[model samples]
Target: MSQISRGLENVFIKTTALTYIDGDNGILRYGGFDIDDLVEHTSFEEVIHLMLYGDLPTKVQLQRLKTSLNEAYEIPQQVIDTIYSLPRESDAIGMMETAFSALSSIYGEMWNKNTNKETAIKLIAKASTVTANVLRAKEGKKPVIPESSDSFARSFLSASFARTPTNDEVKAMDAALILYADHEVPASTTAALVTSSTLSDMYSCVVAALAALKGPLHGGAAEEAFKQFLEIGEPERTEEWFKKKILEEKSRLMGFGHRVYKTYDPRAKIFKRYAQKLSERSNEARKYFEIALKVEELGIEKFAEKHIYPNTDFFSGVVFYSLGFPVYMFTSLFALSRTLGWTAHVIEYVEDQHRLIRPRALYIGPLKREVIPIELRG
Candidate 1:
């Protein structure tokens, strides 16, 4: 029999306006909006609406959508308190994963088909709240539920930091959110679509996506990037540390490589500027940027053929670092943005007649082996 590719890692399985991944070229777009344009001109909520509904909303539509999202933002105090009860040092991604798992416990009775759309909207809306509250709770601050009038992006930044952000901060973070909103049906998004394909509850689908996003190589990269920064300390030490790292780690440079883009990730390009702007506010900004550029240049020179281009993670840490976000909250923030794409994909999957996503897997293990007693057979 001929070998068949099922998961189709390098093949397109479906067409979508939700996002475009030109991995070979290292470009990403959502619903016709380039990642760079969206980051420069739109809010996270606006981007979310675009992905879901296929166009940037008109003023009235944007208002109504924002209103609905804000309305759904008031999560139960029980949820907030549950997050509070987790250990302060607990991983933010793990907390989000657990909190989402527990969201079902509170809304278990509502877990049916009749409420799927409503539930998806609610999950999309409350995602920012969940992530923001977890960050606050980790710091022993009372989590702020969204105020009725706040934009989703503003409310999330305020709730997480316990103060409203400056316009510049909002723009930077909104860019970060929009940039991370989707990445062309990554593993986590695929997990979400597969779950939704089963007609599983939307909340369950989001929960499953969270599980996939918690992996070390995906959303976890930003956190790892930050950790490497801390290990490298000041800017002057960067060269020494990076050199030692390449020698000892061999093929890995933490945030320096991309799996797809051969040149540079466009998303990373935008954040590189934002991170630079943000660093100007601090004495350490120049040093950090220099270190980042050095890493990128070195990685390109050493591993360009391997597609180890500077990725989104390359500058993501610098942005979060300049903004005062804790390293561990990196993936939680990613989850909050990606909730939009997850729901959009779920909605898209629901429109299909088939509710299954069965795919063939290459089997390399013995096909007809019988069970044997370990000690006796040996």
Candidate 2:
């Protein structure tokens, strides 16, 4: 039986160039390129094209895709007003969910079952717009629509702040996006696939994915890791804090441990470098860098023997924090990158409609017995 049919096993369905797992050696690959290679040598937009179209784009092809995304990066005024008027404390994930729900009302006809490939392309291109706009609105700023000629990574970063980004900021964000662009089918991606299997619209599928990614164990970790640093108070005290934290029932250091990666997370190594560069570029508080380095060192030195290593979330926290992104928006940006992978998987599923992903469950309760009347049962 296939892993999808078994349900409990990690289901790593194959693709021509995608890699799903290295359960024994702990590696991740996409399109035959190791994650480490892609992050250093490729842009996030290029990676998205690679996954979706199944090969790296030529310079001309990549430029065209960037242009399409840039054109699609504007939100309607009504959507912006709705987002800005929400209460300040509204959960970011909830904001995304509500935003998507509202979008469904506006684009009802474009997301129909019979919608053509052109409509699908627009949805894929515009996802970054809806996402970046929400983050800016929550901060009481107007969103910047992307300029058609702007680079994909720069447009996303700039749109969130409604301003053009500096060269350094764009470079850092580009690398961050590439690093996060995909990871096999995680639990949240599975949630998206399951939702899409029901023939839900693209907005709903992406919203379901955002909800799943918002939990502490998933996309929520990057922000939580920084929160932990704040609570630690001093860089020198981190090890002691960890000692105390490990004993507390309420504590688990987010971003330090990953379900995958018995060794270092391939993407983390690339992001770690960018985090350092970003720290210097922004002239960040030294404590953040100090704490991050200590955490990474300690994570490996103390926990490597036990198979715990820092994931992409740890260093990404520093990179994003230094870039002035609110911690709550960490997963939203993650959603931005991972959206490409989600669409790719959805397209693959639509192509391979061999099964609806139905799986069996083990019944562990009492054996079947005769039913009784309500009074007798009580």
Candidate 2 C-alpha lDDT tens digits along 267-346: 77777888887777544535687788886776677677878888888888888888888888888778777777766676
lDDT agreement with native, every candidate: 0.77, 0.72
Model 1 TM-score is 0.90
Give the candidate number with the greatest lDDT.
1
TM-score result, candidate 2: 0.89
TM-score of each: 0.90, 0.89
Off by over 4 Å in 1: 1-8, 106-118, 362-378
lDDT at residue 253 of model 2 (Cα atoms): 58
Error of 2 at 309 (Å): 0.5
